[model samples]
Target: MATAEADVPTAALKVERGKKAPQFKGRDRWVFYAMVGIPTGLHVLLVWVPTVGSIFLSFTDWKGIRFSDITWVGLRNYNQIFTVFEKDFFQALINNTVLLVFLFLGPTLFGMFLAYSLDKSIKGTRLYQSVFYTPVVLSLAVVGFMWQSVIYSTENGLATQLFGGGEPVDWLGNQSFLISFGDTYGISKNFAAILIAIAWRHAGYIMVLYLAGLKSVDNSLKEAASIDGANEWQTFRLVTFPTLKPINVVVAVITVIEALRAFDIIFVLNTPRKTEVLSILTTNNLLGEGGGNVGRGSAYATILFLLCLGFVIWYVTNHYKSTEEGAES
Candidate 1:
């Protein structure tokens, strides 16, 4: 009886397998092919190809004009980046690092504060949110130019007219270093000016992100904390903030990326001498405006890529590990 029952189950399994796999209809199959193949082809053609080419070019002296002009120079480009052109390169690095640090310390925290306030349903809360989020809607180019002409312009900017008492202050042109690190590196006053504009926009973006995260938190948790005699600060620090881990991670990555990819604003600001960062330097070299060093530009891109990749990988791995632990617990 057991053998007969087993044979019956095996026959049913064989029958199920014999029922052919579902096939797409003629139109649906074509649609699927189009949807997948087009995007895959474009990605391979545009992103991957260019990236690989640039990496190869980084090891060679490619003028970026002719294919035949390419000549492999091994690590010479990287060598120059560290030794020969260390002045601007290191300055760019310092500026990027400073920007990253400042954004996190200033804008990210402030935005969270704003989001926390707004989440409490204050009077005219929607209006306040809109006002803060306006800058985020504007492109970096618009933000840069608007600030340049309306606030930073030496002759007639609001700041110049108001602060200088008629005589305009050269906010963007000032190359005075704020904090000097030896003779080679220091924080530029003009870079600080650009950072202000960046922070204005960045704060709004972070506020929106944090606001979303804040809204999703269970109010019951807050009530429970309050019932337990926990104050607002304690509740936030111990209960609320821990729940915002995902948003915090996202904001951290965005801040780092914005600092690294700060081009449009710096570009519109006339690529100021003192305000040059890695992105601007990379473009300057590749386009021949500064030194036409394609190899160096490629190397700079690679370094930036590595920095971003490292942060992303670390964040993703930690996020998943924590998630798995929480599930197991």
Candidate 2:
């Protein structure tokens, strides 16, 4: 019996060594190439081609009409942006910064609070979640219209009835600066109203993201924290929050991107005066009436692109540095 068992082991080893790896040939090889190549081709064609083209076009003067009309201007468009359109540029920059700050302060924190509260498995949790999350699924354009027509309407709007105190408030049309800065740029009342609408939708999105992160947290950690006499806030700050580092990063990136690229809702609301963002400016220059100015528009686009790219680069660099330090430790 011992001899037989030893022979069986040798036979299995020989069989394993003799077995050949499978190889793809002809049809299988073509299928594998297709699986990889198709998506790569599409991504390059759709994303990189346009991006490179836009950067190239930024240095030239073009009316976006014909290739023959394209003129090599070499930084003239950028010069005009900083020199001629300085006011508009700075105003848009200020608005973008304000939106970024507001999103971080208002919706992000509120959403995290909502998510933490909802995670406790209270009664009617689903209904509460649905109520908060409903706005996230709605298009920004629709949300804009709803706010404009139903909520912020100057005449019989809900805001007028509730806060106006028998007086109608012109929420969307008010261009008066709420916080003025040196007679040049300020946060407009209209923009403030728009921010509320944006928050209504954005808070829901943040809530959903946080809720997902909360769900994945191990219950054992919470119980352990509780056993150690940690209060709710202490447990969250020390134990729960550390586990949600990935989600926090995602939320931060999304908030910054959303603030930077805010266009659709403002556009839907007819882009009130004193509320122009970089994206709105890009659209106006690129596709506005009177034969679009391709060069200047492309310049605007490149600047916006660079801002986004810079942030992403910074975040990635910081993340990797921290990761490496952690690994070394």
Cα lDDT tens digits, model 2, 1-329, are: 45555566555566556444323434555787888899999999999998888899999999888999888999998999899999888888889999999999999999999999999998999999999999999988899999998999999999999999999899998989999998988999999999999999999899999999999999999999999999999999999999999899989999999999999898989855889899988888866472388898889889899989977997899789989899778
lDDT of 1 at 38: 100
Q: Name the regions of candidate 1 deviating beyond 4 angstroms.
A: 1-31, 165-167, 315-329
Error of 2 at 165 (Å): 2.8
Q: Candidate 1 lDDT (Cα, whole model)?
A: 0.86
lDDT digits (tens) for residues 129-233 of candidate 1 = 999999999999999999998999889888888888878789998888978888878998888888899999999899999999999999999999999999999
Model 2 segments more than 4 A misplaced: 1-23, 314-329
Total backbone collisions, model 2: 0
**C-alpha RMSD between model 2 and the true structure:** 7.1
